[model samples]
Target: QIIEAIESAFGDGPLSGRHVIVTSGPTHEPIDPVRYIANRSSGRQGAEIARALRDLGARVTFVTGPSTTPPPAGVEVVAVETALQMLGAVQGALPADAVICAAAVADWRVANAHADKLKKDPSGRIPTLEFVENPDILATISQMQEDRPRLVVGFAAETSDVLAHARAKRARKGCDWIVANDVSPETGIMGGNENAVLLITADGVEQWPRMEKSEVARRLARRIAEALAE
Candidate 1:
């Protein structure tokens, strides 16, 4: 199995030494019990990353939103639904060696969520909904004072000028690294198994050949393991 291979290569040693935190899945901003704003991220990539990290000897606390994929074995998993809940969960699991903000978090949420679904009026009146910005979970964790992780990784899912936007996000978020990806409508990378990503760091941007999500997670976990050991 993939896990056995990673353990054999890295060592069967327990991840008794360090802690890691990861976030994944799409946060649902509820307009009501029946309506909500969300994204297409399946949390598959994030789950795989947590599994890979665990395989390479790191204790992982995965905070995730709703997703069909099950949480990986041998890691503490916390489930959350809204953006605020996810943020609180990740912050609570912090003081880690590293944090990966892999969730496709929503930029905005409903300002006022309805307690009950509004019924249609025979008068043909249209109901209005207000939206407000959600907290930037990645930026918040990256800038924490007391327990900031040594390395903070964020994901940039953009359509055009992916690198440019990712670099800007790196500076804006103040994270050590940003994994950039082009998720244009045609890419189908959102819910698909394959991904093409660029690792952006302070030194420079490194382009990685398109690979399976599992492969990306393995390579990335190795890189993080080496970085932590340093």
Candidate 2:
């Protein structure tokens, strides 16, 4: 209701007619009823991006996993847990004008997630586990033949060779742009307040100085507005 009020109040803003879908946080793939596999994404950047878009008068659908940061106001929020759930939520939110995939999805999930917690054996025996690959949400959206968003952006968290990996990811995923950052332990960017990122596009790469994640989101939102306008 608050989101509707905001939209009605600012119907003439730059992104008024635009619809954007943003996927955030780290997806948890369950290994058992109690245990799961997940990444370290705090979902700060993605949440900030959703807020920035909403501030620009865009109708935003924020699909997120188990994020520490709360979902921003003036946007629709869809909470999910696993990679599959995130993908489903994102797809359900489309067909959006733009899609930003910032979720750090687990690469693999336990093929046989036990109904209950597995207990240790008294004979010192260990249980073997099988794995299955999770769906690539970014790639699936980017390569869509119909109902594909006009703009598709993805994020890459790399510890080394940031630009190279980011470029490869953009090509492989078929996303229009990729925001890459170094998340090495020394950089403190994984869960830090500030971030230094490289925006990789087919035209070239643009290195952005370290700044607050909120600032980055604002800049990215402006760029998105411009691109969509063109």
Candidate 3:
């Protein structure tokens, strides 16, 4: 509701005339026709981020994975299921001012996925599955030599040593900033309403308090606007 009110009052906000691309949710890599690899992402954060960006008057192209949370108003939503399809959708919406890679994309996919569901073996012989690495969307965009967005933000959902992992990921992926959070089962953040995150940048790291995802989105959008303004 707060976001809705903000949207109504919004006119030529900070991000006016700017283009932003946001990737959200969990990419499903099919293991077969029925089975697939995915995470516990609800896509609430991504939706809120898109809404906040739209509230600021930026044109947002939201590339979302399979998720239950609905996309917010006033944004172009491109629905995709696999990591490869998400990459294609993002590339198609290129030449943006910023790209927020908030999606929890699967790292590996079933290389030799069966065409049909495999029936259970009578002798209890389990079938073996092959795995392959998915494309690194964040690194690809960050290292792009031409038409790269001015700002690229990535998310690191870690179980332990969150800061260290996030810092390493930022250096490795070459993104402008990284939002790291502990998604351990105890934290209940994987599909929860709140998030506690650390913002890691080239300058330094700042710890943000646990808050509703909507508030986090609003804060993040404002920061993005500020960074792009400079």
Q: Identify the candidate with maximal lDDT.
A: 3
lDDT tens digits, residue span 1-230, model 3: 44344445555777877899999999999988898888999999999999999988899999999999999989999999999999899999999999999999988899999899978899999989899999999998999899899999999999999999999999999999999999999999989999999999989999999999999999999889877776
- Point out the higher-scoring one by lDDT: 2 or 3: 3
Show the colliding residue pairs in model 2: none
Displacement of residue 165 (Cα, Å) in model 3 is 0.1
How well does candidate 2 score on lDDT at residue 53?
92
**Best candidate (score: TM-score):** 3
Superposed on all Cα atoms, model 2 deviates from the true structure by an RMSD in Å of: 4.3
The RMSD of every model to the true structure, in order and in angstroms, is: 3.5, 4.3, 3.8
TM-score of 1: 0.92
Clashes of 1: 0
| Candidate 1 lDDT, 1-230, residue by residue in tens | 44444446667533336798989888888999899988989898999999988887899999999999899999999999999999999888878999999998988899989899977989999888888999999899889887689999999999999999999999999999999999887998888998999999888999999899999999898878766665
Q: Give candidate 2's error at residue 185 in angstroms.
A: 1.2
- Alpha-carbon shift of residue 67 in model 2 (angstroms): 1.0
lDDT of 2: 0.91
Please list the residue runs of candidate 1 whose C-alpha ends up more than 4 Å from where it truly belongs after superposition: 1-16
Q: How does candidate 2 fare on TM-score?
A: 0.94
